[model samples]
Target: MENDEMIIPELNNETIESMIYIIRGQKVILDFELAKIYGYETKRFNEQVKNNINKFPERYRFQLNKEELDIILRPKKSTLAKRILKNI
Candidate 1:
């Protein structure tokens, strides 16, 4: 079958790679990234997560520490700061 016939949606390699990195044994997504993907604002994404804290266990979701945040945002800023600041 041709490549276009593949069942998986066609995504750019960078996006696929980012997904792989994000899903590395953890259900985590930065607020900005999740907002972009879900078509919501970053603040709204954080509000939902906060409202449904139980739905997001540590394994499913958690905020990054300053060091961790530094690592993630060093290359580029992420809206995760909103939640991280609150969680801390």
Candidate 2:
């Protein structure tokens, strides 16, 4: 596959479950997690989603506000997670 092409990743239930979080009373996966699952850089994944906005319904996508971002980042105990979040 080309570098820009996405793989049809086979995600196990445990892997998917680990990525899902309850935010705003809705189950959600962070964009970075989705990027990892589908073999794209987070920025590229977002670009693809925006370019093909019609493919994803409103319920499938939303931006994180500062508070929501905090909520997602706050519980993370890993320095790597913090660094990744900050860089992204």
Candidate 3:
């Protein structure tokens, strides 16, 4: 294998089950995790999904409360909100 090569894991029941996360009573799979299963970079995977975002019934969306928004808009340079805000 070359330095740039990747080894895709087998998607058996256990592997898929391990990727599923339960948050707030809802099952979720992060896009980066899903992209890894198919051997695609996260940006490429997201671009493809963005082209057809509404096609899937299981697509997830969430709304932040006022307190959540306030935290995300904090002006500290080292805060995690910079990355989180970009994704929002």
Candidate 4:
């Protein structure tokens, strides 16, 4: 094969499994990941969706509840009011 046509290494099953774990386990990704892949910051990504909330729908994105936020901010003891902050 030509240099440009050289075969690239394939991701094995284990690598695929690890990718799935990372996506689901990491509740959120940083701005860098969004910018690199989707050409936007996490805040921008959220705002665009928020502006078109009807298009996105609740099931697609919804704020975390008090209990859910508690788990997220675990050991910090967040106030009930703060915990109910709307997530975009």
Per model, state how many residue pairs clash. 0, 0, 0, 0
lDDT of 2: 0.76
Clashing pairs in 1: none
Tens-digit lDDT string for candidate 1 (21-43):
34345646576665555655567
- Model 4 segments beyond 4 Å from truth? 1-37, 73-88
Per-residue C-alpha lDDT of model 2 across residues 1-88, encoded as one tens digit per residue: 1265446455789878977888878899988777766777778888899999999999988988988777767677475376556537
What value does the lDDT take at residue 77 in candidate 1? 52
Model 1 TM-score on a 0 to 1 scale: 0.56
lDDT of 3 by residue, 24-75 (tens): 5677665655666666666776776878778644538443467644643454
lDDT (CA) per prediction = 0.59, 0.76, 0.58, 0.43
Off by over 4 Å in 2: 1-11, 77-87
Off by over 4 Å in 1: 1-13, 19-27, 77-88
Ranking by lDDT: 2, 1, 3, 4
Give the TM-score (vs. native) of candidate 3.
0.52
Error of 2 at 37 (Å): 0.5
Instruction: State each model's C-alpha RMSD to the native.
Output: 9.2, 3.3, 7.6, 11.5
lDDT of 3 at 54: 85
Q: What local lDDT score does residue 17 receive in model 2, on the 0 to 100 scale?
A: 90
